[model samples]
Target: MSAVNDTSFNSAVFLLTGIPGKEDVHLWISIPFFLIYVISIVGNSVIILIIKTDPSLHVPMYIFLSMLAVTDIGLSMSTMPSTLGIFLFNYKEISLDACFAQLFFVHLFSFSESSVLLLMSFDRFIAICNPLRYASILTLPRIAKMGLVCALRSVALVFPLPFLLKRFPYCHTNVLSHSYCLYQEVMKQACSDITVNSIYGFAVKLLAVGLDSLLIFLSYVMILTTVLSVTSSTESIKALNTCVSHVCAILFYYLPDIGLSVIHRFGNSSSNLPQVVMGYIYLLIPPLMNPVVYSMKNKHLRSRLFKAFCK
Candidate 1:
């Protein structure tokens, strides 16, 4: 029973490709994906450049912006390169090991990006509501430490995924739907009973998506309370405006994350097609949207980026 299951699980027959009919659409789909990739890179790179050059924007908010940009770029780069390559070529095959490796890093950075957004929200809260103590609370050393902590936290949480998957006997299918290797997607292809994999994946989500969202929600609650208490309308508006980009970023960052977690936990494996599409949308959309959100909402970032590029 187990051997037959393993063979079936490891076989390429399990791989889902473009629906048997709409093969032609693959070429066209890449157009928008390629465009978004370009925008994400260029926009994030611009944010980094502007931050480095414009000392006036060197406060904690921009520092968090820089961190968020870095994480966004890192997350997009992990999945985009391989995905884009597939659009241009015929042999879109990946080894099991390579697939899991990409999955681990992509997930690790995705979680880290979430943590960074949470940190950024907190930074805005301090800057807007607790203006007097913003500098004291969000000093350079503290930002650096936060970055290190989140990076370490994400890596530690996700690194075990690859090792755990390697233990599952390769039953059959190696072809991953969409671009990168995903846990639930690949677990269905496992030779062994996937109960263990499912359990561990749930645990990963608890640490990654579960707690991350809680912290983010709490941070915003504090921010909203602080913003509302202001006596001066101008001060209140300014404080609220300061959080605009952060709120947009958080929405972009969390909506898909929460959506994916629910799909993995509740949606049937047969319905993975929707989840796969949703995964790419979430993965690709946020990075591209971050710059749009920040550029449109943040006058300071806009002005600094303009001045830096102009010079």
Candidate 2:
């Protein structure tokens, strides 16, 4: 096997694959994926429009929601096209530059979503724990700043990944595990020692997604403790109710994520279906479900959504 470690590697391309052993079902598979892409795009778009158009939703909670919707849209768009192309049209050839671009945006939105969730957790924490200070604490400017920080942080961390991958010699098979590119998946195809790439990847994931998840969990624990201490049972339920949608959103995002991580790290490569299915779930479910959960849980938003559609 000849090692391609020169400048020519800058133009090297990779063939993205559908589920490894399930090519025959690619056409049928495309249907559900297309539907999911449509739903995720439409659902998040509606959430953004509703929030922007409604004066009643000009609060911190809704502002945080809008940020989440935007991130969801970004996430859906980053990977959906290539994913569908691979499954439906068998367009498997992806240029190295294009693959890197996809990797950056996919990871950018992923970490952005994690950051937004952390922000949402803080929003809930303030609303539940210190209602009197909620308005004063999370003003529109502050929320905007938080969103900017999340975006910048995600970009800064994920930006280094493609460059790092570019430096490695790709003498092995250039076929990726999924229809989309990922840091570890791409790294695994390298021929040389990837000690630096491995460590950096671990540190990035730990610092970004892992730390954010830990903080969100702690925020919820504090929120729960505070809610349970409330004197009235009705009040406790009401407080907890405010967090239910966020809790569901968190679970929807992280559970599939953890499952995919486990499968990638520990599962057998011979069985590709589980990993592919879970990858689709991880990528598609949150964006599709977030607006639905939020609309159903928040009466004000739901009523406004209904009135807007009825018009």
Query: Which candidate should be chosen as best, given lDDT against the real structure?
Result: 2
TM-score of each prediction: 0.90, 0.96
Q: What is the C-alpha RMSD of each candidate to the true structure, in Å?
A: 2.9, 1.8
Off by over 4 Å in 1: 1-21, 268-271
lDDT of each: 0.78, 0.89
lDDT of 2 by residue, 197-296 (tens): 9899989989898999999999999998998888899999988999999999999999998898889889998777888779888888999999999999
How high a TM-score does candidate 1 get? 0.90
Error of 2 at 229 (Å): 1.0
Q: Which stretches of candidate 2 lie over 4 Å from their true place?
A: 1-8
Model 2 residue 233 CA deviation (Å) reads 1.0
